[model samples]
Target chain A: MSLLQQLRLGFRSLMLHKLRSALAVLGILIGVTAVIWLVAMGEGVSYQAQQQIKDLGATSIIIRSIKPSEESSRDVGSRFGISYGLLRDDYERIVTNVPTISRAVPMREISREVRHREYAIDGQAIGCTPDYFGMNRLTIARGRAISEVDMKGYANVVVLAWEAARKLFPIEDPLGRAVQIGTEFYVVVGIAAERTAAAAIGGSLDARQYDRDVYIPLSTFRARIGDRVFTLRAGTTQLETVELTQITAVVEDMKEVDATADIIRSLLQRYHKSVDYAVVVPKELLEQAETMRAMFNVLLLLIAGISLLVGGIGIMNIMLATVTERTREIGIRRALGATKGEIVRQFLCETVVLAGTGGLLGVAFGFLCGPTVNGVRMAVGAFLPEVWSALPPNIRNLEPRLAPWSIIAAFAISVGVGILFGIYPARRAASMDPIEALRHE
Target chain B: MNELQPTVDREIVASIVGVSKVYKLGGHTVRALDNVSIDFRQGDFVAIMGSSGSGKSTLLNLLGCLDRPDSGQYILAGRDVAAMDDETLSRIRGRYLGFIFQSYNLIQQLSVVENIEVPLSYQRPPLPGGRERCLKLAELVGLSGRLGHRPTELSGGQQQRVAIARALVNNPHVILADEPTGNLDTATSHEIMDLLDALNRAGRTIVMVTHENDIAERARRIVRLRDGRIDTISEVRPALPVVSGSIALERL
Candidate 1:
């Protein structure tokens, strides 16, 4: 028979039992959709993490000081109780000595209660410089940030975190208004835009959250609040000395950070007795982020693979049942001068048709799932722009990536699965005794 | 008993020396055919007669190359068909053997014209004269009126007619009929018998295996088989003065 006629016959045979065919195709459909969606989700998450890490400045290196333990302090510099940790000279020395050092910004964080009239909020008070604005990706909502002149002249000005500003003064313009901090009132120079928290990349540093932070110049902080400071407690006359815990730096040339950090380490080694100094390169975090992405991809592929397997099983099931139903038909064809090869070809054609239809439908379902899922998320997100604003740069700009070769591959594999499952039944039909088949009801 | 199977050789035109077919059911073995043997030359018209279980169908299958005897040599047109392998048997059946069964085993999906093409398909190059051959066969079998009708769409008699045309398509040396009129009424049976008679007169060899004595009487020679053995073979002389058919004697 001609190929066209064979196809027509196959289609009609399938249509004869509509429910059975649909059930078979459904198995394939579910499997295919699962594969596409799971892979997409895993890829989406890993991609989001990578960009977040890259935004941390892939080329940048960070150096923070670590305090020495009691054991290390007992020998050498520790014998005289020469304190270990970030010395003021370490910062000044790197700036002056490192050849590739393009620009450097130092930051110190402290917790203080800022009060404006009746409202007060406890937040992190950060000591930073002019370059900190551009390095930390801080955008101004209103007013201006501390400039080079402000850091040089030790200006008593501060920048309010978006959430900090909202909590302390909900309806009022906090810009240019003075807020009390540790008995010293500072004017709000600018309001920083809120940014999404950095995802955990590796064991290097904790995630940086911009929600509850305040920025101030390092020079101004050193002048107003010296290194040796103490706070008094109620009823006990207890004193708490503020120890500088973290010094976040942004180097101008990202490539120089590792070598620069090593130099600073050796310089600090001569004067220090503690292991309290930890130099971190944000690029390491980027590497960890990529590793995570690779792991996620493998996981997604596994999930997709399971679904495809199920779909193949479904095709196998359907084809098996179909062979039984068409037993008599097959016998009749054989009797009517059709060879065993012809019979095989006819049934194989039927399976190809089933797979072709199911594969196309599955791909379409998978393609459409992204939009439908995203639409629901967007609908719910209407109530909160803050959450939507933190959406990763990749997903915020919607794009439906259609891998053409994958579509074709999926189509071909579906059909192949059908045929593989179809063999036993086709052979059964072909091997039947023609005389007995004629006598069969 | 000595006639268990026919003697087999390379040159015998058609031989059934001594063939015995036994069917085993549980511990009991029933003999379907009992030492039957017979011989006939090419282009000879012969009929087999017996009651149910008398092995008429078994004998017919042996003649048509559809089944092998338990013990017998069946030589057909100079070939030892009984000794041939299944593939050779199938090929031989395709090239030379033709069968007309009682049920008229025409495929329901195929039209009358397509049904006639079944045996012809087995031809190596598929003997040419595609449409013209189909038309001639249809006209020969009086199926010109319903060539396009499927088997179910046609009457039992009409379907049998298509089966006959299919049998004749390959232009084989021998034609085997197993109760070809078993399902047809008396008139239709007689009509089909007349058609067979006309073809036989035109030099086509026909073998009819039937229980009906009346059907046996139509043939030129009669062979009676019982207990898987041939009991008698008698030349039949017709009692009636025959009338000619309206259809012309056309060579396919």
Candidate 2:
């Protein structure tokens, strides 16, 4: 028989039991939807992580000073006011000795109270060169950031972070206004824009919040603070001296980040006797992120495949029942001169049609991932404000990213499952004895 | 019987020699047909009648190519078909034979026209003008007006008419009817028999199996089976001149 004719026959048979056919289609629909929805969510998460790593500067290496252990502190704290950290000389050496490093920005920060006419807040007083602003993706909202002339001339100018500006100068113009930091007065030159905090990436890096910070020239900081500060405790006084807290070395090319980071680490190990610093390469983290995304997608696909397998089993069960129900019809067709292969083809066609229809519907719904996720979040926010507020910021702001391959792969697998599961039942129907089938009641 | 060959004349449409079919019901073997032989010529209307389990149905099944004999040589249209495989049997059935069942065996989901097209769809070197041919057969079987109706929507006699149209749609060499009137009322049975009689008179060979003697009498020859063997073969004479005159008036 012509394939078209067999398909027509198969369609009519499936239509004879509309409820059963619809149920089989529903099984496949759920499976395909799960595959698309789960993969989209996974892609969204991986994309968010990779973006955070990229924001940290994919072609840069960061060296941060950490407190040494008690045994190592004995060698460093023997002389009072002799602190251990990234030195100013070390930054100069990295810039001059390392040919791969295109630029190096040194920064030092200390927690201090700032006062602007009785509106006082505790904020970090930061000293950095001009390249620090662009390297950290910090934008200036008003006036201008720390200029190279300001650092070279040792100008006493400062910039207020977004939250600090709001706290200290709520309704007043703060730019060019005087703010006192630990008995020293500095002029506010600019205000930094608000930025979302980046999440911590592994144990090597800590979470960074860019708001509520004060910026000034590194030359001015050394001249004013003098690299010596004494804190009065409950009974005794502690004196500490630290020149630079961190140094960020940017490479001309992304491929040279690992080589530069290794050279910097060896340089620090030779200059500092105690282990008080860590070198972090963002390039390595980016590679790890890519590998993790691949593994995550495969795991999600396997889980989705299991659901589709269950859906295929449902199709096989229904097909087997349909064959039993239509034994007499099969006998009639055989008597009308249908071959065994034609009978098998007829049943297989019905299953493929069921799966194909379900797959098309699933792809249509898959595109709704973004809107659906947002709608659900809005509903939760409206009904359960407390629960919504408790969710992590990442979850609150998640945007589902639909991967095109998931749509194609899920659709192909569903149809393939239909054919694979259809074989046994179709064979059973084809192998039935004509006399016995005709006698079936 | 083993050495029997085809005769020079090609008028014989089918011949069977020493065909036996054995069925094993659980552990016990039942001989459905035992050493039976028969011959049917072209343009002949024959009926084989018997009681239950008398092997009439078995003989019809073998002749229809729905099954094979345990041991025999059966020839149809100058071809040995007893040992043919399924694919060959299906092609032979589609090309050279048609069937009409007692229950009207029409597919419930299909309209009368689609059911009529069923056999033609199986023909290789596919027949063109299928819809036109189906419509013509529907007119021939007096079901042209009911071509779009499903089997369930038709009466028993109308359904049987649709079955007859389907049987003739492929224009096969012979039509096999198993108790064609077994499920119809007497008036409907007579109407169906009249249709068959007209078809036979129009030079189409037919083989029918019926238990009723009156029904068997409609055919030109009646072969009776008893205990899995042919008991007697009888040739029914034509009707008297009065009946012939009535038939002639009816034809007018």
Candidate 3:
């Protein structure tokens, strides 16, 4: 039989049993859709992570001094709370000597209970220069944060975070409010805007609570508060004193972060013997995010492959049944001098048609899946308004990143699956005893 | 159309030597053809006649190269069909031997003209003017006006006639017909039998398998099979002519 005639006849058979053919193709449709939709979602999540890391300043190197845990002999539950990590001279050396580094901002934070008449809130007292706000994206909502003038004179002004303002004075303006920190009192000079919570970039850093923070000049903290400040907890008997908690260094560009970090690591090698300091490069975090993205896609593909496997089995089953139903036809075609290869090709063509039809429909369905997911999320979000505050990443639906190559790959793989499973049934039909088949009632 | 070319010597159309066919069904061995040998010459109208289980069909299949015997050589035309590959055997069948199945085996999806054009599809370099060839074959089979009709639309005899045209489309050396008239009524059977006879008169070799005595009588020679063996070979007698009476003049 000619190939065209065989395909035409196969099409007729499929058309004759429209519902069965449709059901058979639905399996493949769902399989292909799953592959596209799941892979697209994985890509979307990975892309979002990379963007967030970029926003965190990809060139920035973070050096957090983890207070040594070996000081358990002196303290109870917490580590040593004092001047630890690399010396102050090392930060000066990094800024002056390393031409690779653009700027270095050293910071120290202390948690102290602050009171205002009846309302008292416990929050972190952040000690850093004015340049720290631009580096960490802390925008002032009411008044300006401490500038170079305040850092030079060592002033006693403070900035209240958004959460502190709402907690201390819910109905009054917090611009000129006075809050007492331990035995000292400082007037509120500014209110910071809300910032995104830092959820640890790959377990290298701790989860950050950006809401409860009060910014003060580092020079003022050193002169007035001194290095050994204490906080007596309500339940605990000991005091918590900390000089500096973190130091963020900004390198010139992406290429310099590695060399500057290497230089700083060697410099800090002699300062601290313990493994207390954690230096983080957002560049490395970005690379790790990309690797995680690839792994996620592979995992999704494997899950999608199961559906494809089921689709392949369905094709095999239908082809086998078709061979049985067309026994006499096979015999007649054989008698008419069709080669066994021709018979195999005829059956394979029929299977390929089923798979191709399914693949096309699946691509269409997968394209619409993005909108469908967003619609469902929006409907649920409407019922619960409190969840709106949790809607930065959730506000936008997962962008379906349709890689052109993925579509081609998916369709090609589906056809390959079809042919691979189709071969057995085709061979069975071709190998039938012509005489026996002809005599079949 | 010019009749089979008369060569210097007539070729042996088929030669079977010590051919045997055995079958195993439900673990019980059945000998379909046993220790049988036969020679068929070109231009010979041969009929294989036997009752059921006599292995007539088996012998027919072996001769057509559709089945290989267990322990014998089958040479059809000039090739050893028993040793030929399936692909080669199919090609040889398409080129050298035409087939007519008991069910007519006309592809129901095809028109009468397309049915006749099937065998011609496998012809080397293709037959020239396919439409013309198809129309001529259709006219020869008395289906010229019904060329556009599908097989289901044709009568049983007409369908068989179309099957006959399809078999000869490639101009094969022999036609192996497996009970071509089995599905037809008495009148239609005779019509098909007459068509086979006319092809035989045109010098095309034919081999038919049938148990009907009247049907077998139309062939020039008959080979009777019994118990998977050839029982006898007999010549068919021509019909006796009726005597003519003296003419009476009725003119005034």
Per-residue lDDT of A192-252 in model 2, one digit per residue for the tens?
Answer: 9997665454243445666768999999989987677687868878777777878988999
| Superposition-based RMSD of candidate 1 using all C-alpha atoms, in angstroms | 7.7
Among these predictions, the greatest TM-score belongs to: 2
True contacts kept of 3: 0.43
Global lDDT of each candidate: 0.70, 0.85, 0.78
Give the C-alpha lDDT of model 3. Answer: 0.78
What tens-digit string does per-residue lDDT give for candidate 3 at B1-252? 012222314456777899999999899999999899877656567789998999999998887777888998887767788978999877777778888877898876678998888777655556567667778778887888998898899889999999998888777777899998899899999999998887766667789999898999888778899999988888674311121111100000
Question: What's the DockQ of model 3?
Answer: 0.34
Off by over 4 Å in 2: A1-9, A67-85, A110-125, A137-142, A160-174, A178-185, A191-214, A223-243, A272-275, B1-10, B237-252
Which is the leading candidate under lDDT? Answer: 2
Question: Can you give the lDDT of residue B42 in candidate 3?
Answer: 61
Docking level for model 2: medium
> What TM-scores result for chain A when each predicted structure is judged separately against the true chain A?
0.76, 0.86, 0.77
Name the candidate, 2 or 3, with the larger lDDT value: 2
- Candidate 1, residues A208-266: lDDT per residue as tens digits? 66878878887777777655434455653322222344444555666766776677668
In Å, residue B216's CA in model 1 sits off its true spot by 4.9
TM-score of chain B of 3: 0.88
The DockQ of each candidate is 0.18, 0.59, 0.34
Candidate 2 clashing pairs, residues 3+ apart or interchain: none
